[model samples]
Target chain A: MANPVWMVLRGVCRGLHLTGYFCAFGTALFGALFGQPPGLRRMGWGGFGVALLAGAAWFWLQTADFASASSPSAVLAALPLVAGYTRFGWLTLARMGVLLLAMLCAQKRCWKLAAVLSGIGVLGQAWLGHGAAMGGGKGWLLFGCSLAHIGAAAAWLGTLPALALGLRLSQNPRALAENYSRLGLVCVGAILATAFLQYLFLIGRVSAFFTTAYGAAALAKLLMFSVLLALAAHNRNRLTPALPASRAALGRAVAWEIGLGMAVLLAAGVLMQFAPPAMAMASMGS
Target chain B: MRRSLFAGAAMVMLAIAPAAFAHAYLTTSKPSAGTTVRLDTSSIRLSFTEAVQPEFCAVTVVDGMGTHAETGKPEAVPGHDDELTVPVHFQMAGKYIVTWHALSVDTHKTHGTYSFIVGN
Candidate 1:
């Protein structure tokens, strides 16, 4: 276990990193699907830069935590040992490398190529996360669910700014809204399904939910997610259909969605830092 | 906007500090992390802060001579889920390095190595 201050610091780094990574992934993906809008291009690059910085910080904190060293020099000295020896270290390094590659591709204005590269990088996060430790086919299944959950989230939250841009620039705002509404629905469905599967695997019995740290945080995240889903539904069914007339409302809705999305990401950051409830209970039983 | 982003990031990081914990830490050991032992030392024992899976836990001991010094597989004590015991087989001993990898019941994996003198 880490000290309270360090734990919070690490969690924040992880939350911001996920936000940045998803935003970059989403922007690139949208660009690949449509033509690159200048605003979207800028946002993607910005996200890539943020993700890179936050990721490096997270790595630094993890090294310090693992080595039980707090000073900058001490942490740096321990870096090679952690990075060379631990599974967590390898995954972090791999993720950082992918982020760099994605950034380079985005800089080249290679939208589609950037999207593919960044997507791989984004999915690689599943390895650093909790579910990646399970053995055999079960591990792969959980990994798949985690990947889908993140992909859906990236598509929904990351592309909101781009979607807003489309509303401003396109002559047929209503058509654009309609197309996005359909895409949003699919993303929502996938997010819900995959999240549910992950919950099932991590929580096991419902009793563990109230008794474990991971479970409590996970429950909070689920509540936040439900609120986010409601906002999405409103945008998809009511606000989006109103189009140019509802543009202001749509923008506000998306902004709120983004805020809630950040909250959910924060919860997830905390959740990943702990052992799942089921594991804790099993340990207790033994 | 930039300031807000920075502030938001800082706030979230601070807020999560008290809630996160994972992996296992070595709480006790027969030879300990870095200590000198007797020439007759014959086994290595490690006690962790969390219950670990025996199947996924392993300890390897190697002497300063770069030869294998541990024989067979390490096993967790039957009633004590947190303790791992491994037999050490070595005649010549100066310093022996012990490397361990543990997968806690929660599926978190951790590995570390330390050196202990066989004879002082």
Candidate 2:
């Protein structure tokens, strides 16, 4: 069958990633305020969860190759649904989810119960993620980087939705600002660290930057990162200290930062789909 | 609670320290993995959706009987990234296997083997 043109366009452009962005923002918004109060945090999280489940279901319903749409909850349900599928789709998701849960739970200070359960989840993903192409020590690198990327993104971007909810609730202005400043710095740091690691993998040679495909992608990502850095500098060096004339303004700047962060993550979703240039394994004298 | 958060941060740092560097994978192959193709096979191609560590990728046609390689290293042609091909000039059609090992853009290495028969 001829592949659907729409799916092809969406696949390359990462239209699903757009939904993933909103869903991630939703998850972060709700998760941040999970125990805090009433309103959207309550309704939005529920609504978002339903939206996610429905999206997952809808994705699965459209799929024809999966033997059957056996379970709506199976992450692989999207395999038959997404255009130009990756062989390791379900495996990749399981790997990312498992490792993410493990990292989340292994905290020496986290709830023992949560840690234990998440630890179990990690094991499950390993069983599923095992593939000749992806696993072992290197897989750990992929898992860790992917988690940091997503976590930092959620913390950074999700804050916007949270801030909006906060404004609606009329929470203490001082409390919100203080919390955001502290948390935002942390998120920025996390994002920076992950980007550094990714850079180490990509920056093979100075000349390659202009000559290589990998280099070009890296350069594009760098340009985007630079813009964010400039915006962040404005927020931290100038706007932040001013007390922003209004708390709402503080929230808006954060929303802008979060929006940029989402764009970065969008590139990330596509980039991750590609392989590392380091492993290009130039077929020398084969 | 704060302590747990800090601890979570620490564990993540340790776990991610290693993986943030992973590369790409070779994913799939043609010639019906394990099946044999003749020496005249126009192209022996390996495809990876991501940019690869060209320095590390190998597309060698190894003679099953002689244990000799059939070609110099294959190269990624300009423009097409999804596939990299090596033209094989088989001295003669014999049983052969294409063994490959590659490092992906994220720097993760993946290796695999596929066989094809070259015969009248």
Candidate 3:
């Protein structure tokens, strides 16, 4: 799709926004359940701040997109109208409120409450993407899947830094790894299952997987995920058992997984920006 | 070098942020966006930059006096995937406002309003 630069801004906004929320939720949720690492705590607070700022920018950018206006003045002029009237605008407002609460929670060191607020922020995100377009029962179902997908992903990718922190602190790093490994496996399973469900809802046809922009982005994400899985398996079976001796290697692998996860997220952001294959095929037919 | 690379990436994202979006746009409209039109007009037609769902699309034409000029549901023009036609009961000479909400087949929602004088 040949879009005006505003959409690109929106995409970037969405990318940053999601990244912030994921990091905030993951760090807080893990910190609350496990030992709160000082580094992860700082990161969670920073991520929450970023999400709030990015979300505001995204709202302005969307206002510009809706008004089909380009200049800063135009965006400002349209901002009130879009924010006041549209469902998206209202959702953005709600998200902002949730984020504010999350920040307060973080400040109070109420990691559990902060995590819950972050989860609310993440769950509400489904309405801004392709799932929002789904109507009737299917839309609701897809939305549920999207929520599950995001929650699982946060639990997995979001907690890696915390895990790294744990590895660094715990004397019995092997025991820590074994415990987290079990939880990580469950998180991965949920991520995969929910992702597949979302794909089925969005793609609607196998051929679309090859022919559409969304399909191509999804394929790229899948490839990245496959590599991530391989790296994870190596860490779980090989490096993890080695414990403190292999701490550096395990840390490096975790860092690599985080990088790949970010790549996957970027692909996801791209996918949301394009029409799914079903829509593309329908457009072609029309 | 790593810090510079991160900064460069941030710069690129910011520079390219406002350049692309996949949402549909109001490409054209009958009587145009802001112009005077004769009272004899029987319908309003809008063209979008993308194909839209006819069932989910809506259009309303109201005069300055708060009287509804729209007479029926908006429809996709046959053979014209991007165009929507709405029947209107336009007769009085006054400013008419056309508000349209469309759901593009790609699931992007776009809406806008345009006003035109119905009398010379």
Worst 10 residues of 1 chain A by lDDT: A277-286
Candidate 1 ranges beyond 4 A from true positions: A280-286, B1-120
Model 1 steric clash pairs: A8-B13, A8-B17, A12-B13
Q: Write the per-residue lDDT of candidate 3 for residues A1-286, one digit (tens) a residue.
A: 2373545556667777777777778877777777675677677777777777887787777666566677889878867766665667778788878876876787688888988887788778776654444443555566677778877887888777778777777778788888888878998999887876666556655577788767887898899999999999999999998987998888889889888887777677667776654442222101
RMSD of each: 11.0, 11.9, 11.6
Query: Across residues B68-102, which tens digit of lDDT does each residue of candidate 3 receive?
Result: 99999998799886789998877689888888888
Q: What digit string (tens of lDDT, one per residue) describes model 1 on residues A1-286? A: 3655667678778888988898888888777775565677788878887888988898888777766676999989978876776666767778767766876787788878888888888887776655454433555677788889988888888777677677777777778778877778899899977876676566665676688777888888889999998898888889877888988788788888888988898888877776665443222101
- Judging by TM-score, tell me the better candidate of 2 and 3: 3
Give the TM-score of each candidate. Answer: 0.73, 0.52, 0.72
lDDT at residue A57 of model 1 (Cα atoms): 90
**What tens-digit string does per-residue lDDT give for candidate 2 at B30-115?**
55455666656666777663445454466777776656554566666576544566766767766777777654433234566667
- By TM-score, the better pick of 1 and 2 is 1
- lDDT for A111 (candidate 1): 78
Say which candidate scores most in TM-score.
1
For candidate 1, the TM-score of chain A alone relative to the native chain A: 0.91
Q: On a 0 to 1 DockQ scale, where is model 3?
A: 0.05
Model 2 misplaced regions, further than 4 Å: A1-39, A42-138, A206-214, A282-286, B1-120
